[model samples]
Target: MRVLGIDPGLTRCGVGVVEGVPGRPGRMIGYYVVRSEPGEDIALRLLNLDRSLAELIAEHKPDAVAVERVFAQHNVRTVMGTAQASGVAVLAGARAGLPVETYTPSEVKAAVTGSGTADKAQVTSMVTRLLQLDAPPKPADAADALALAICHIWRGGTRAKIQAAALAAARRSPR
Candidate 1:
């Protein structure tokens, strides 16, 4: 399955595409960071982010989108911006008719590094190794985005299979 992972931020939103099945290493299709000027108006920034995400969805044609769920932070301003960007990402996936899932930072870390409290360096190292990349993806955001994709492939894929099986079984049963 092809999955798009988004690490949403006001200034630099990381985007990554990975393709693979459960229990297998994911191959990186592409990775990019969508940048919006901090000085720009909030509405404009969000619009640009939305447009960029839309373009990526069109280009990659992912089966599903995995986004970093917004968590509370001390800085309300920072959290607010992240939340808005995250909303844009979700909307882009929904607009493209793809299943969108959000994973917390801890969930992504645990999926990739087997530790919910893994640091950025550890996550990057694990992601690089898992994807068999020559080097770690630049900027922590980029690695985080790829990690999110890998997490979805590992976790979400299994969930999807189980759900599909249940649905098929239900259809086979009497009403």
Candidate 2:
């Protein structure tokens, strides 16, 4: 499966594409940081982000999209900008008719590094090793985005199978 992972932020949204199945190392298709000027109006920033994400979705043609779920932060402004960027990312995936899943930071960290509380350095190191990259992806956000893709590739397939089986069983049961 090919997955596009997004770590959304107003000024520096991370985007990455990975392709592989469960229980194996994923290949990095591409990685990028979509940047929007912080000084720009919020509407303009969001619009630009949406356009960039749309182009990425078109170019990569991912089977699914995995986004970092927005969580509470002390700075409301920061959180709000992240949440807006995240919405644009999700919408881009949905517009492309792909399944979109959101994972918390802890979930992504645990999947990549086997520790939910793993720090950025740990996650970056693990991602570099897992993907067999020559060097770690830059700007922490980029690595985080790749980690999100790896997490979904590893877990999403199993989740889909489980859901399919449950649906089949329900269909066969007497009401």
Candidate 3:
């Protein structure tokens, strides 16, 4: 499966493409960060993100998109920007007719590093080893993006199946 992972931020959105399945190592198809100028208006920043994500979806042709789920933070501004960027990612995936999955930071860390509270260094190290890359992806955001992809490949499938089964069971049950 080809998965595109998005680490969304207003100033620097991380994007990564990975291809592989569970119980096997994945290959890094591409990884990069999309930058938006702080001086730019919020609308422009979001627009730029949307365009960049759309371009990536077209270029990579991923089967699914994995986006970092924005959580509540003390800084409302930061959280708002992240949520906006994440929305753009989901929109891009939907526009391309691909499945979109979301993972929390802790879920991503646990999937990659076996610890929900793993530090950035730990997650980066594990991601590098898993992908067998020469060096860690720079700017942390890129690494995080790759981690998100790895997480989805390793866990998202099972989660999706479980959700689908639950939904089917619910539909069959009496009200």
Candidate 4:
């Protein structure tokens, strides 16, 4: 399965792609950060995000897209901006006919670091190690995006195995 993970922000949205079979660790396909200025008109910024996201999806042809769910509390405006960015990502994936799934920040951190409250540095460090990369993904946002993809692979594989086992058992059962 090929998966893309996204970390969305108005100023900088991150994208990463990983591909592998179920029950196997995925290799990174492509990862990068999309940058836009906060001062730029929101409409224009969103357009750039949308276009870049589409290009990535078309280029990678990911089977699924994973993204971080918003959980902002103190900054309503920030949350809204991030949410909009998330929507743009979903739209891009949908446009390419790929399924889109979201994992909460805590879920991603816990999967990647064994702790929901792990800090950015910790998450990034572990992501680097998990992928066997020599360095952390660029611009922090890229690392965050890759973390979401890793979390989905970890969780999705569990579900996929259960379904596969069920199918195998049914096949073996008497007609």
Assess every candidate by TM-score. 0.89, 0.89, 0.88, 0.85
Candidate with the larger TM-score of 2 and 3: 2
RMSD values for the candidates in order, in angstroms, are 5.1, 5.2, 4.8, 6.8
Error of 2 at 7 (Å): 0.3
lDDT by residue for model 3 over 25-131, one digit each (tens)? 89999998999998899999998899889998899998788999998873786888888888888878766767678899999999988899999999999999999
Instruction: Give the number of colliding residue pairs in candidate 2.
Output: 0
Candidate 2 C-alpha error for residue 135, in Å: 1.1
Error of 4 at 174 (Å): 41
Off by over 4 Å in 1: 158-175
Clash-forming residue pairs, model 2: none
- Give the per-residue lDDT digits (tens) of candidate 4, residues 44-120: 99999999998888888876788888876837868888999998987777666566777888898998899999999
TM-score, candidate number 2: 0.89
Cα deviation at 168, candidate 2, in Å, is 19
Q: Write the per-residue lDDT of candidate 2 for residues 31-120, one digit (tens) a residue.
A: 999998888999999988999999999999998889999988636869988998898898788667677788999999999999999999
- Give per-residue lDDT, candidate 1, residue 162: 55
lDDT of 1 by residue, 34-138 (tens): 999989999999999999999999999998889999978736868889999999998888767677788999999999999999999999999999999998998
Deviation in Å, model 1, residue 103 alpha carbon: 0.4
* TM-score quality measure for candidate 3: 0.88
